[model samples]
Target: MNIQKLAFVILLFISFTICSFPSTSYACKCVEPKSPTKELRESTAVFSGKVIDQLEKGRTQFVLFEVKETWKGLNESQAIVETVNSSSSCGYEFEDGKEYIVYTNETDGHLEVSLCSRTHLLSAASEDLDKLGKGEEPSEQVTLDLSDEDEPPVWMMLSLLVVGFGLAVFYGIKRVKKKVNK
Candidate 1:
């Protein structure tokens, strides 16, 4: 119940609260089910093909494509059309032997795409976050280069020196007062 003990307990409580705050996470970074195949999940490639086969592989449904339009950065160059049971929020429907465009972007090496969108079809125009990884350079150019010898911006160094001098003066006065008290 002493003041020092109460202050220590309060400090400990504050430290614990600050340390326990929730951390941020990216879902795409996690590993996915084996059956779905990493290629089918995070590929940024696009190709046109007919859905020739569809089936369930383990917990995941897959669809095969017979590639017609070839492009760089997709799962593969080509495959005979096939369909497997799959679901997505991007509004793509699969039917046997139907010719359509297949767009895939893999997250954590898992495939995802906005099916049937104009942007998806135009591979060059893809704006998916997966395609453009985090911390991308802004398209606009703005440069503020500081020279190697550039002193800390004058104002910053001045303020810091002022604070240091103030602390020194405070301690000096305290020492003088203690000596006089003695």
Candidate 2:
């Protein structure tokens, strides 16, 4: 009847609204990479490091690296690099407590890296190691000092806010429809 038709129309509208949200994931497009030596020459900082921590803010993931050795551009034993979250966006994913040979280029005063760069996990970077030879040792050992936290992460807070808002809207619509029927 009319009630069934109205329900179908509401469902279709809700489906369309959900489908219109912007997608964060994307396909990565990159040109053929240059030689290792060329990549090194073009990079502003080349080093091996362990990822101590990572924080995501907006579209960028901030990685805290404890530098072990330096081939170029880094003077501090600790550095922060910015990368995207998805490889499809050319972002390089660095796992916590894992060592990697990172090649970074300076972009607007921050170190940036992508999968298209010469960066790789230490165990898989033998070819790049052979090309780099022995790099300079870090002047001082760096350590992470993370404090214990009891609060939930930012994403969790945002998700809760969204769910609360959606429930409020759903109930409001249902109340309005009930009032109209009565």
Candidate 3:
């Protein structure tokens, strides 16, 4: 019957879709990291700081740091550095309350860190610290919060509204169908 052929076609399409699009993960491909001296020269900000707070939104992570020492670029006591949300996305994972010597580059107007950067936990950066030599305290005090950094994307807000509207319409249709069947 025509219905059997239609069912077969639908099944074939589903199978093809599933087989064609296997689950995939992004893998970060980075060139070998440079030396601390070379990396410091390439950076927009180089400082040792403790992570105070972090906020993840979509694919971006905003990290707030309390700056302890400034070797280059940073003049403020507080700085916010942005990174990708995943290691697969080349993001460096910064744990809360942990001190780190961070190297960041200016990317698209934001100071961004990556797994490829010459950044490390404070405890692990002794050799780099010795090579880096003297550091000065941050001169200016500035406060930055994760909330002040990002607002939800307009497309995300619109997509949510559309999904909510669709669900309400589907519920109304189901109720109408049930009443008609009664």
Query: lDDT per residue, candidate 1, 21-125, as tens digits?
Result: 776432222233222123334446645555666544432345555555534354343342222233332334566667654556555565544433322332333
lDDT for 55 (candidate 2): 82
Higher-scoring candidate on TM-score, 1 or 2 = 2
lDDT string for model 2 (12-106, tens) is 87788789886655788889977778989999999999999898766788899989888999867888898998887999999999999999999
lDDT of each: 0.46, 0.84, 0.87
- lDDT tens per residue, model 3, 63-177: 9999999899989999999999898989999999999999999988899999999888999999879989979999998988787545778699978976985676567666766
Q: CA shift at 76, candidate 2, in angstroms?
A: 1.1
The TM-score of candidate 3 is 0.72
The most accurate candidate by TM-score is 3
Give residue 5's error in model 1 in angstroms.
47
Error of 3 at 80 (Å): 0.5
TM-score, every prediction: 0.33, 0.65, 0.72
User: Residue 179: error of model 3 in Å?
Assistant: 24
CA error at residue 34 for candidate 3, angstroms:
1.1
Judged by whole-model lDDT over C-alpha atoms, candidate 1 comes out at: 0.46
lDDT of candidate 3 vs native? 0.87
